[model samples]
Target: MSNQTSVTEFLLLGVTDIQELNPILFVIFFTIYFVNITGNGAILMIVILASRLSFCGPNHVHHFFCDIKPLLDLACGNTELNLWLLNTVTGTIALTPFFLTFLSYFYIITYLFLKTHSCTMLHKALSTCASHFMVVILLYVPVLFTYIRPASGSSLDQDRIIAIMYSVVTPALNPLIYTLRNKEVRNALNRKVRRWL
Candidate 1:
């Protein structure tokens, strides 16, 4: 008889290899994972209640947080259904917001060019969308690179790098982008600074 056993669980390659660092890593990653869930869950809830978004699941994740690609990577049984959902359901979740954002900018540009015909207004509108657009690009480009292909082509190391790019780097830069580009945020910050002085 063949002693073939299927994989039932996965151990993620965490941030460190040192046994002593395990506890610290756990705490840090747990906090990050918790916040990631809380934040994304809030958005999911909003989408669910406001619109009609749904998700079904299996219970393994290769990445630190419950990102879709990582979770799919750990699917214990055949991943046909999971892959389908990734294409249809997850694709909708990921791409719809991007498409809508794109359309909004498209309309804004169209209105500015055809209706308004003001270079100053056009520049202002583009500038207003710039930060948001940059954030979207930062997030979605990596995601598309990671998920928009057949899973067989994905390298775990590559996925990890890109995952960090979208998950950590994009979120970290978002506020900076907003603050730098947004006069309103700058003014509010200046007001607070003056008061503190």
Candidate 2:
């Protein structure tokens, strides 16, 4: 009988190699994970309620996708609990990653400054951070804006626009921003520019 294990390989850059930073990293990751799971678990209740409740009104979803708010709008009964659940989950999913990412950046900047004391290195680091943070801000801000407002105040048109921002714009920008930082990408762009010239 073979001792069967399906998992083949995995790679992990242990957050940080520094022993001193382990505790801080652990807490940050754990907090984000815990809060994220808890928020998602709350949605299960919403799902259960969706099945139990009688849906009223036109089946037409106002938004592009069947988002929680739009779905709840279709429900016959009062959706106070469902709305609250959606808001809470959205807030957690949106904010937790944003704040934690910033925290990581802060620590990285501090560490780099203290260790190297190189202005060029700091500038390079900040540029990378700025690009990443830009993406994070673009993605999270619109999502938070759409979800945090009072349900009554939610404009479907506005949401579709915001959805385009976070869903379409952010993702489209990610590869462009990150790839621009690569040496190979720079060379490729330079070649293209030279050919055009």
Which residue pairs in candidate 1 have backbone atoms (N, alpha carbon, C) closer than 3 angstroms, thus clashing?
Answer: none
Q: Write the per-residue lDDT of candidate 1 for residues 1-197, one digit (tens) a residue.
A: 97687655445444567889888877887997986786577556533432232335555455666665565455444555556545554555677778988998888877778887777887888788777789889988887787677887888778889988988999999889987776788889899999999
Reference-based lDDT, each prediction: 0.71, 0.81
Q: Ten residues in a row with the worst lDDT in model 2? A: 6-15
TM-score of 1: 0.56
Best by lDDT: 2
What TM-score, over all chains together, does every model reach? 0.56, 0.72
The best candidate by TM-score is 2
lDDT of 2 by residue, 43-144 (tens): 787788776777767888888777777777788997888788777777777787778988998898788878977788889888888888887777778988
Candidate 1 positional error at 166, Å: 1.6
